[model samples]
Structure formats: C-alpha cells, structure tokens
Target: MLLVVAGAGAAGSVTFAAQAEPADPLAVYAARIVGDRARTRIVLEFDRKPEIAVRYIARPDRIVVDLPSTVFTFPEADLEARGLFRDIRYGSMDADSARLVLTADRPARLVASEVMANESGTGYRLVLDAEMVSQQDFEKLVNDQSWMTASVDATATAQRGDRVGQSEPAAPGAFVIAIDAGHGGIDAGATGAATKTQEKEITLAFAKALFDRLKGEPGIEAFLVREGDEFLSLSERVTIARQRGANLLISFHADTLRQSNIRGATVYTISDKASDRMAADLAERENLSDAVGGVSDTGEPAEVSDILLDLTRRETQAFSISMADSVVRSFEGQVALINNPHRYAGFRVLQAHDVPSILLELGFLSNKEDEKLLLDPAWRVKIADLLAAAIRRYRLPVVANGG
Candidate 1:
C-alpha cells in the first residue's frame, strides 16, 4: 500500500513499493493530496502515461478529469478531502471510461494539471494543482467549455439548456411556469421530525403534483427545475427558469427552524434587506445549500447597475410580490400559513434579474403536525391544487391582455 504524509514546509512525500504488473492497460497505484485551504495539489502515480481530458464545471465549482479505462488500486484514504477540495472521488464511469471528480470548497481553478514520466522512466505521474480564484475567474473557466472530451453526458448537456423533454420550443403564447424542487441528492434540505422523511422527497412529490395539476391547463406549460433527486445550485435553478422562458418561477422547500412550533407555508421574494430577522435567518440557511452539497457558495449574484436592467428588476420584483400575495390569499382557508406569509429576503434562488421568482416554504419539517401533513398524499394534493389556483389567478390578467 502507498502511504503519504505531508513533510515540513510546502512539500509532501509518498512512499510506494513496486508491485507486479497488472493485466489492465492502465492502473493507478498511488495518490496523495497536499497543500492547505488556499491551494491544493493532487498527484496520482500510474503505470503508464494515459490520455486525459480536464474540464471545469460551475454552479458549484468542480474540476473533472476524464481518463481511459483504468484500475484504481490505491487506498481510499490516500486522497482524502482536504485543503481547497471539499470532496474527491474516482471510479469507473462506464466500461471504457473512468472519471475523477474534485469538488472545491470555494471558487477554484486547476492552475496546473499534466502528466509526466518519472525520473527512472518506469512509470508516469499525473499532477494537479488547484488554487482559489475570484468567482469571476472561475465563471470564466466554466464558460470556456472547449474540452476535447469524447462525449458530454445528457445531464451536462441539459444543464446548458437542452433538456430532454423540454428541447422542443414551447407553443407560442404559452405562459411557462418553472417549479423548482429544492434540496436533493447530497443536500437533503430538512428531515421530518416524526416520519424522518427527507425534504427533497417532499418537495419533489409536491412539485410533480403541482406540475400535473397545471400541465392540462390551456396556454400553460409547467416543468420541473430538477425532475429527479439530484442537486442543483441556487443559480442553476434560476438559470433553468430563465432558459425555459418561464414567466414565473416558484421554488418549493420544507425546512426546520429553531422554533419547532412555527410550522406553516411562507412565500418569499428577493430583497437586499430581509423583511424580518426570521426571513434573514432562513435566507442564510437556504443559501448554504451549495456548501452543504459539497459545492462552494459563490455569494450573491452581482449587482446590476444598468438603468434598463434596474427597471426590469423593479418590475419583476413587483410581480413577484403580487404572486406571493396571491399565494397567501389562496392558502388562507385551504392550507395553513405562517404569520406574515408574504415575506421578502435575499434568497439566491430568487435572484433572476428578469424572472418573477418566489421561494415557497411548504411547511417546517421540525413540527410533528406539519411533518405529518407534508408527508400525507391527500394533503399534498390539496396544497398543490391551491398553489395551481394561485398561479392561474396571478397570470390571469397577463393572459387576458394577450401577453
């Protein structure tokens, strides 16, 4: 087994023992992680030089290395999470390809990544150096997707806006609504107190019910931001809405709070300053979804100063507020709502400059009563129906005016 320990100063050493050649064309026998929080280095010793492709992905900054089929025989602890990296994984992607994914703690870039032969020429070494960078620089790296990788997965392609079921253009005059189901995959949002059901499952079920309820309506097109139990960054959620040309974006979440007694639906719109302490605290927690899912929090979206864009945002915010009010009104007797249900906060998922967006807290999972209701299929159907009614009411005026 290869054992690695950091030495004094900025260097580290990996002790390896020679082993018999493996039948596989390529094999990685050793790997190590070196450096600190500001920078990180990863070295992998291979039996021979292997063709590699590197790509940078954003919406939670990650570096991906695509390689030919190979056997990874190193100990799992050799490349444990440390420094700038929050998590690391290497495994077979398919029968012919292998992948190494590195998720950063913050916006980062691979400053150096290359393969070179060892001094004795018996093997090759794959070295990668990652360093923290400004969000702008990292975004630039993500945008430059000129990697020569042989193929791009469906998810990656869809993330760039060519979704499978949504590639076809919406019928003209259709009022599109993008329903975002918050917290999935590695980030499970909140867990139910009684049933222990995950928030992701709840949101997805509600989102689907709402979508099914709305899809049959005339001149309306509803789609899910994340159709499955997969994680998406706050920005990606907003981007999906924008790319789909959605007139309204509604994000569904069920979160726990310090006050377990507080359990009810709340509609939130974006604001530079939160409407109250509760709003601020909730926004802070929800914004950390990326970090919780091993993706770096790149802070809020950049402030736009253009006069036209500013005006557009003001109009959009007004629409968002109106939608929130409609939601609260629709749930008045049909569903429970927290005090001051129409609140405003600087939620990243609601920061799409032109899209009218709102984050809807279905109900706190911390409260046993609310947890039971959140998990009840009948309750979900009732709530979804009410939400669909609210959407129709909010868009009625626009639809009437031939908008």
Candidate 2:
C-alpha cells in the first residue's frame, strides 16, 4: 500500500513496501529525486529517525547534509540527478560522520526539510524541497549564516591548543606515525603506462610494507589511514591523523606526469605556495580527489586567522622540512631520487596544523623504468627499510628530548 514513483513522471507505477531492520543501528535504505529545473524534491527512507544538520555553500551552489554514524544501503542509481540538482553524492566523511552533498546547476535553496514516520509506521522519511534562488540571495545566505560544525580551520585551532598543553612523552615514548595510502575506492589515481598498475594499489602495497617495518621497531607505533580499497576525502585524512595523535604523517603516492621522461622518488612538504610549476600542477590534481569521487568541495575556509594556529603551522612546517631532508638523505645512495628530491606545495592532505607531515612519491608511473621498479617486491622492501632508517634517524633527537 505504498505509492512509489519509480522514476521522474512515472505516475502509475506502484510497488509494495517492505521494511526490515537494518543490521546497522542507523541506515538509509532508499533514496529518490523528482521534479525539474526550477524546483525539486528529494526523499530518503531511513530505518529510524536521523539527526540531520544542513549547510549551504556557494561559488558552486551546493547543499551538504551531515549525519551521525550511518550506513548507506540504497542503490546509487536511486538518486539520479534531476531538476535543480546537477549531482548527488553520499559517503562517509570519517568513522563517525556521513555526508550527503547535492550540487545544483544554479543557485538553489532548500525551502522545506522534514522527517516524519512513514505510512508503514516501521521507518522514517526525510523529505527535502529545493527551489531556484537568486544569486544575490544565495550569497546573502552564505554570508549571513556560519557553519557551526568544526571546519578544518577550527579543528586546527583546537589542535594548536592541544599541542600547547601537551605533556612530555613517557619513557621511551612510542611515536605514532600515520601512513596514508593515497587514492583509493572511486579515486583510482594515476595509471602505469606499461603495466596499467593502479596508483592506489601501488601506494597501498608500499604503505603496508612501511607499516610492517615500522610496527616492529622499538619506540614507534604505525597505523594506516586506510585499510583497503576505500575513498577518504583530503580533509578526512587530516582529521584521522590528528585523532590518532600522530606525531608524523607520511602519505605515499605514485603519480604519473605529463613529461614521461621525468621520473624518480620525490618528497613534498606543505607550503603556502608551490616551489615550482611542476609542484603546483601536481598539487592541483591531487587536491581534486574529492571532486573525482563525486563529492563537492566543502568550500570551507582553509586559512586560519588565529595567531596561535599560524605559529603552530609554521613550527610544524619546519619539522616537516627536517623530515623531508632526512628522507632525501636516506634515499641518496640507496634509492633513485629526483633532482632536488625535496619539494614543497600546498597539499591539502598535509594540512594537519600540529602534526608534521610529508607526501612521498615512490616513483612516477609515467616512466617505464620507474613503474617496473615500483612493481618489484624486492625494491619495495628496500625502500621500506631505507624509509625506516630515515624515520629512526629523525626521531632520535626528538625522542631523547621527550617529544
């Protein structure tokens, strides 16, 4: 006895409704969209009442919905782009948060959003109605209301405070190192020209090797940002590292470049500006992981106006440079390194203000020789050992001084 609109303008279609408890405590079982350019309706059926928070973003007009820990069980095709919505995406923001982003072809605002028990009385429905709005109005909305959630800038400020009051490490302090394997799930990164080896796979393999090598070392604790083929936003990566209390974060990547002849391992640290055109171009593409995964940019402000946070970032950047230098020195005779191996760029993944971070390019997949070396297990092991040595050398003084 449920009226189901199978698709846009499908008025006669009727489907029986079935409700079952989802294994997860909270979940979205179904989703649909209807209507046209000027206005639209979005409906989602949830297993239970969900606490939802909404935010409006401009530049490219979009609406973001934040939810508590919840599983999305609906078919991807269910939320087809129609009406005012140009694109729709739903995914995990982190371990505890999920997000739904709706991008519009033009400025649009949700005029109505409500949750109510369904006719079956076994589930709940979240209904949203959006309509086109003037660009001026949208801009007004964007400026008038402040997003209350902890944005990247706010989180970094909090982290700055955390570092200020940090206590000395225990005897033989176990330094936590976060190994982030770049590009996974929907974002398949760059491809190897010869072997067609996915960059995600290569990065993951090297991350595991590095983690395995570091986990057994004394005074070191290592954790992977991702365990499998899963997508994580750039901001989410930073959040995870900070949550893990990581002292250092090393993100591994194997990228392909336009110049096929250019290839070697390179180390990158975050900077306000790129050191060179190549670094800038690479950072630009790497920052688009979220867009590639169908998620709109959060459009949250990145710059922190707080003086304490700025100071923390500067100090962290220095430590990152020191770590990068250590890596370059370790790879000098042991592994092939790019000219001026250490580079700098505005990499979003390295934006954790209190945690020193570096992104290591294992090799360029564009070069046949580099790709071959990247695929070799023995070569990966050798690189992992060298990286371990670098980390150990870098930590010696810090550990002795009670980091």
Candidate 3:
C-alpha cells in the first residue's frame, strides 16, 4: 500500500530488448539472495538491441545471476505488494552486475519470479509464497539488517588472512557457527564492581578465543559477526549469522545487576512468549538496545497487517527453545550455571529461523569470582572448547528434523 511509484510514462507502450553495441555497451541487471537457498531472476532492457548470454544458478540458501555491468532498483509498486520482505540490499559484486539480497519477515518458498515481455514491451514482476516462520524467526529476519556492514576496507580485508575474495570458491557445506559478542562499543554491558572491567571487553575477548578454537577444529568453522567495540543493532547480529550460513548462532554476554547473588552462565533462545517474567523483562530491555542508545524507532506507520505477522510467529518457536537446551548442556560442567540454566527470551539477535541460535550469559559481573574468571585465559579456552562441541552436537538433531 505504501509503494513509492511516481507513475511516470505513457499508458500503452513498453520497450523491450538488450542493446548489443551502443556508444557504451549496456549491462543487463540481475537480482537474488546469496546464501543457502539461492533463488534468482533477471531482467534486461535496451533502447534498440538484445543481450547475448547470462549465467544464473540456484544454491541451497541463495540465488545468484551473473550479468554484464548493470544496476538494479525496485519498481515501487511491486515492492509495496510484498508484505514479506523487510529490506532489499545490494552492492557491486564486481565491475560486472551487482549482488542483490532480500530479507524476508517470514520464511518463503519461491514458486517463481521473473522479468519477461508483456503485451506492450518488457517489464519485471516477482512472486513468492510465504512459508510461515515463528515470531522468533520473523524477528531475526527483521533484526539482521542492522548487523551487516558494507566494509570493503583493504586493511581489514587483509587482516582476514584466510578469507576468500569475490572470485574464490564458495565455502560449500562448511559448518557455519555464528558468534555474537553480547554488547559492543558504547554498550558496556555489565561492569566489575572491584576490577572495573567492562563486560563488552570480556565478551569480545572470549568470543575471539572461541572463534580461534572453532577454526582449528575439523569440520567446524566460526566467525564473530562483530569484530570491534562498535555499537551494532541486535537485528544486525542475526543478519550476520544468516549471511555466513551459520547453522548455529551463539551470542555472548556478561552482565551485572543490583542482585549481587546472581552469578554464573545461562543459555537463551528466542520465544514467541517469554519463558518467565524475569526472562521477559531481560528480553524487553535488550530489544530496546537501539532505542536506549538514542536511535529513533518512531517512524511512518507500517501498512502490513497485524494478523499476518502473528500467523508467522506461530510457526518456528519450538526450534528456538531446542537450541537453548543444546548450548546449556554443551557447557554443563565446563561453565558455571544459573537457575534453570536453559531459558527463553524474545531476543532479536536470536531470531533466525533456519539457524538455531542462543544467547549465553558467560557470568555475572556482579560477582567478584565470576569477574576474575572472565578475565582469565584458561577459562576462555575451556569455554570455547565446550561451546564448539555443543555446536557440532546440535547439528545432528537439526539436520534430522529440518533437512
């Protein structure tokens, strides 16, 4: 309903064809998501010519089409009809065409979408049917937009010593473990009463340690979605995991509160309904990370209906809870435990549907013992080993149940 169509152009005529050679050769345009379930569609137009050949392929989690130098933008009206997608993202893949990414609110099954000739000339239309995902899943999709950054920084790229550039072979079937360091940059999380160490710093150190251990393990790989002490939106956290094709996502956090007795670790997965009142409150506070940090949530009202959103929420929650249990058990003896170690909260960062994700509170900064342990290198290594094993163990059930 909120399409940004200018309504320009005559009513009847449409021009269709890709130009062969003009003053400069025109490149055809293509769009598709680029991960697990690769679904692709393309459109080409020219004033007086036709395109030669373009290559497209469908991967397990994404769809990609390779074309000549071309840029793509959404035609306003068609975008409005989509109640499913939260955003459409793209960047230049190379000097050739661009890579288009779509984030959907609910999991979707792409029946068919294409750009072809109409009665008058040429046009583009894409169609998709929604596959219901739980509210947890939908929220993860919504949250992902914030986690991803378009960094093409050379030094950072070089720092990624083993990372593949655009031309490298896709890391197919590589087990993806999503690492989330609970708070970042300005978000100090919990503070040590005695040592005065920040929770953000401890979590980042621990996350990086775990990432290194995962990388060394066979058949397993890991990456921290956030590399620095930068403020990242919770949704962006989930986006990082999904983009990396993570099968399991683990978010790290260490916090403090007035309740001095509270200590030890806890594992949390997303839930449509919070598991307990305390869990609900914790989730509410975390969800407001963006707003609390001074980002405005007040904006133009969404035209999407409430009923449809609720329907999607009903679909994927149980899987989220299962992930929490997987992690709590994984760290059983190696880490300290909190009351009812496995918990459920409405965390935006733990929302990806296809991937099972959980948030783990490494320990409470309120406790002196916990704070010291958090700063220890030995604890980081032990915790990382426990975490990696849990990820590999969790995969068995997910594959049998979902795939």
Q: Which candidate's TM-score is highest?
A: 1
- Displacement of residue 23 (Cα, Å) in model 1 is 25
- Alpha-carbon runs more than 4 Å astray in model 1: 1-161, 164-166, 296-304, 401-403
Per-residue lDDT over 80-105 for candidate 2, one digit per residue giving the tens place of the 0 to 100 score: 88899887867554344556778888
C-alpha lDDT score of every prediction, in listed order: 0.71, 0.72, 0.50
TM-score of candidate 1 to 2 decimals = 0.65
Winner by TM-score between candidate 2 and candidate 1: 1
Q: Considering only N, C-alpha and C atoms within 3 Å, which residue pairs clash in candidate 1? A: none
Write down the worst ten-residue block by lDDT for model 2: 1-10
Write candidate 3's Cα lDDT for 191-249 as tens digits.
67667666666767777787888788665566676666554556556555555566656
Model 2 misplacement above 4 A:
1-172, 299-308
TM-score of each: 0.65, 0.63, 0.54
Candidate 1's error at 244, in angstroms?
1.4
Candidate 3: residue 220 lDDT (0-100) = 56
Give the range where candidate 1 is weakest over 10 consecutive residues by summed lDDT.
1-10
Better of 1 and 3 by lDDT: 1
lDDT of 1 by residue, 304-384 (tens): 689999887887787777777888888898777788888888887777677777777777878877777776767767887
Error of 3 at 365 (Å): 0.6
**Residue 210 error for model 1, in Å?**
0.5
